[model samples]
Target: MQIKRNTALMVGVLLILAVAAWAVTRPAKPRLAAPTAIPVRVVSVAQQDVPRFISGIGSVLSLHSVVIRPQIDGILTQLLVKEGQSVKAGDLLATIDDRSIRASLDQARAQLGESQAQLQVALVNLKRYKALSIDDGVSKQTYDQQQALVNQLKATAQGNQAAIDAAQVQLSYTQIRSPVSGRVGIRNVDEGNFLRMSDTQGLFTVTQLDPIAVEFSLPQQMLPTLQGLIAAPTRATVDAYLGADTDNQTGDLLGEGHLSLIDNQISSTTGTLRAKAEFSNPAHKLWPGQLVTIKVQTALDKNALVVPPTVVQRGLDSHFVYRVSADKVEVVPVQVAYQNSDINIIKGVQAGDVLVSDGQSRLKAGAQVEVLKEPPQVIHTANAQVQP
Candidate 1:
């Protein structure tokens, strides 16, 4: 039994030694290593004339707007214009019942005719009396009385003529015409509706479409800049944007305008000053009471260091940027001179300096950077090699 156990132990030791030799002699497997450089996209700083603009919410207003109302009390017999129709000044818009006014005018005319006929007869009688008195053929008192009678008839005819003029004025008021060249708004009263001269609500409104105005409000801090623009011989250009856009740099552009005027006083409650700009809206892109976004150019920074907004990052204390130097990046504190939604005018970076625009989340000061201007290089590590 001792001889069999010794033989088995010797065989196990030999097998263990063989397995150790095989493990040591085999080829090592490929292993993974950490990336040496962080992948990032970069941009170069540019020097150019950057226009500085201030943005505000604005409302569109028609330069010429009028509420068409009747001058005389009457029934609106006919409406000659449809809603939203463009009309010129003096274009007939609506008609009132004019039969009563016409009748009054005709009666005044007949009264004037009768009075004039009587006056003509009186004048002829006075002429005859004067001739008779010249020869002493008639009494002087009779000629004087005839002259007085003629004067009285002339007064009656003059009063009747005045009445005819008054009636004619009333007749003209029956035709309601457009007082301004514009587009008509919705009608407040329909045809056959009784209209009173004292009614505050009128038939409709006429608002000028072309050569419109936009009213905007800016903070009082921009007052000086606005004053300079208004006093300039050439008005400052303004741009209006549509919804979700705060400046001319983004979104849909509605129309262009020029600064017209500024309000005399700033609002104490809001700390903002109101301003107005004019635009020739021949296409009717701007309408009355339309809300829009306005961008008013305050100044132009010549040869400004311009960069993408994303290049500048806001830290807990101040703003900073990742400036690329060779293969490494360093954080550089930057001062923003002016910034809009599209670009930023900064002070710390020089023109033509390279900056890391993206992949900043994984980057730190003094970290290596691999510029991702092109596709990343692919490395195919050799599969784990084993040699017998």
Candidate 2:
């Protein structure tokens, strides 16, 4: 009986061991099967001859503006211009009281009269002496003395005349005029305020609005391309807009402008070169210190393989994109030429290749995808890129 019981116990222990072995070795419950299709939006990559563009933020500035101030000092008497009023060059903007200056001018005129009378008397005496000396009628010493007196009196009269002219000029300076045709800023000094020549405080400011400058900066890497663009016999042109929201609201298309200036040195910290373009602000839409966006072509890549910007994807170290293939979504490595909001100019992608555009966040290598029936509109190309 004992032997039979021990045999049964041994069999039960062997059975338990076999079951544990099977549990450990069994394949993970066959992973829940993948869905039959993945919903996605796709775009057909095309080599739409895209003009290369470099983009940067810039500030609008008036072509010529300066703070108007008095060159000569006096009590501020009249402010001739109102704030925000348009003024033309040489227009009187303000005036200082010139009562004292007028008096000084009169005094100089009196001095000039006195010197002239003295000169006339000396001339008469010199003439008389010259007549007397002609036939040894007067001593040589007397004639020489009379001639010297005449010359001295003449010099005194000229000096007095110069003083009078200087006084008149000072009186004219009491009326300050606009140096440029532009809108006038707020007036700092009112009537009865004392002004001084040494004071640098501005009485008002004038800024030209019809034509303006848009200042921007580009990376140093673009220098070679910019040089190439410049070397082309036909200079490129660029357009500047005022309103950031809509191109239409910005005003009559500010006329096209050309590359005006480039900085000699690159910024140490940012590695960028400053640049400027002059655009006609016909409607006065561009203003001083207004922030703006600019699109400029630093270089153009001929026959570049381009794709929609939305198709480009950020992977680990390199930028990759999803190329729709027969079997599944295939990850493609691409070299980017440039990127804008709607499209990207790239080097690796080719024409007619279907690229995954909308659904990429959850995509992985070899992930199956389905293209939505709706297609996106393409941005048509026209107008050669101008250097502005």
Candidate 3:
């Protein structure tokens, strides 16, 4: 029994030593620290004149589009204008074979001459018969008959003259002319081809490109604002842009114009109203049927709070911005009044408030931020006079 008790005490002591060693030598549990600040670029909110614009996709249209067709039926003898040639009004386009018309005119003139000669003879005979009847040299009925012959010959000559005039008018139709000043499109018929007045496919087309127009549609809700602009003494300004960016935020400017017209009726099916603007396309950049982006300036705000569009973030319920305050960023909800690719006119943010433009993906509410760079400050100086 004494030996057993000694062995039990030894085992107990070894167990206690193992437990104490484990308690002293085990690795320490790591404690986590707060997240580090994110580096970001920021810009201060600003107050400036912000113009409100309505945007839409539009198509360029020519001021005048006409198909040049022959007015008479004949073989084309002359092709005066080439394809894609710029022409002015009354320019010769083509000429048809006018030989038939000329021949007919000559025939009518010959008939008129013959009739006139016969009428002269009848008048001479009638004068002789009147003198003879006064002296009772021939019957009164015979003199009256001679007078009727003169009248009949006179009527025939007038009819022949009318025919000559008609032939001359028809001859003029053989000379084809451009009714409008424009550029000629593709030619439908070559020289030596026969053309008819009833031909559906015309000789070519003439499209007026300069001072072009753009047609676009806007939502019906904008009708009132558009009406107000139309009622103003001065026309509203419009801008057309080329290809849009990947995000469709903006595009390269193509040209500027003024509002020209608005459709009388709105499209019930599409819930949109059609509008048109005219641009002085001297450079001929805008082509007919080409698609473009259009912006119509409907109104202007003199003093509006604005910020860079990149600083605004879209959330599930509202748009927000990470406003920087003393090295900390807080979530700020903003109401966007208007937005273009460059700037956003917003509410709920004051001027001089700094907002994060980049590195917002790494931020949350109450997160810390490190400003990478400050925006450049502008200094205005008064005009100075130079001394001689």
Candidate 4:
């Protein structure tokens, strides 16, 4: 019994030592630390009126572009206007060889005078024949013959007058004039060159610079929207840029214009509708045949809940935003009503709500957040005031 007690005590001691060793060496139940807030950039939602725009590729076109061609085939005797000269309608651009034309005109005038004198003499004789025929003093055949001579002379005079008018018209063509008010392009045929009516190329081109038109094409789906713009009470505004940036936030703005017209039919192959906008290009910034990007304002959203584009995140099913509650952010699903490069109009958040603008990649639902910087002052419509 003593031996068994000693063995039992030894076994109990060994068990106690093992327990003590484990108590000393094993890790204390890990002390829990509060979750750290994720660092993020945040911005407050703003309420403002925002304009919605649609972009398209466009080409600048002159409203009035004319090719200065010779109406009559003749020698290009004189070039009065220099290249790149601004001219008005009816301004003399050049002169043709008018020697032949003048000669023909002078001959026609002389013929007209001679015919008038002959007609005058025939009329006097007809009067005398009528008086003698009234008493049967002259034969009926003689009186008839005199009257016929008078009629022949009258016809000759009328023919001569028409010839004179034709000559005058031919003479006026010798002085080539600008048909439109515009700037003259580079000349093809110089002075002293023989020009023809059938010449494929003309002397030069005159392109109207001010109040130019821009031709653009949009998808056929936007036809209804464009029609609304055209029928709007106020003219819809448009902007032209250098590159085809659809957001229209980049590149230099070339000119501003108003929506002019939409094409009668859409292009069957491209499935796009052609549209035009007219811009007041007094500075000549918009040139003919230059390719540009166009933005047309389709509508304006009043009191829109605006936020930075980065604030909205695109998820697999729908878009979402991180709405900060206290130190934590909740993923709030949002619908982007209208969006541009700078701002996005969202539907789920209020004007005073704070949103995560950056550092979204490290975020999730109910994630703790640390705002990196204070948001900018929210500029309200009536007065610029910070949102609480």
The 0-to-1 C-alpha lDDT of every candidate, in the order given, reads 0.85, 0.76, 0.86, 0.87
Write model 4 residue lDDT over 244-305, tens digit each, in one string.
56643566788999999999999999999999999999899899999998888776678889
Best by lDDT: 4
Q: Which clashing pairs does model 2 show?
A: 236-387, 237-386, 237-387, 309-343
Give the lowest summed-lDDT range of ten residues in model 4.
379-388
Better of 2 and 4 by lDDT: 4
Sort order, lDDT high to low: 4, 3, 1, 2
Ranking by TM-score: 4, 1, 3, 2
Candidate 4 to truth, TM: 0.88
Candidate 2 deviates by what RMSD? 6.5
Error of 1 at 15 (Å): 33
Could you tell me how far off, in angstroms, the CA of residue 382 lies in candidate 3 after the best superposition?
25
Q: After TM-score superposition, what is the CA distance of residue 29 in candidate 2 from its true location, in Å?
A: 15
Residue-level lDDT tens digits of model 1 in 118-157: 9999999999998999899899999999999998988999
Worst 10-residue lDDT window for candidate 1 reads 379-388
Root-mean-square deviation per candidate: 11.1, 6.5, 7.4, 4.5
* Candidate 2 lDDT tens digits, 149-180: 88888888898889889999999999898889
Please give me the total number of clashing residue pairs in predicted model 3: 0
Tell me the number of clashing residue pairs for each predicted model: 0, 4, 0, 0
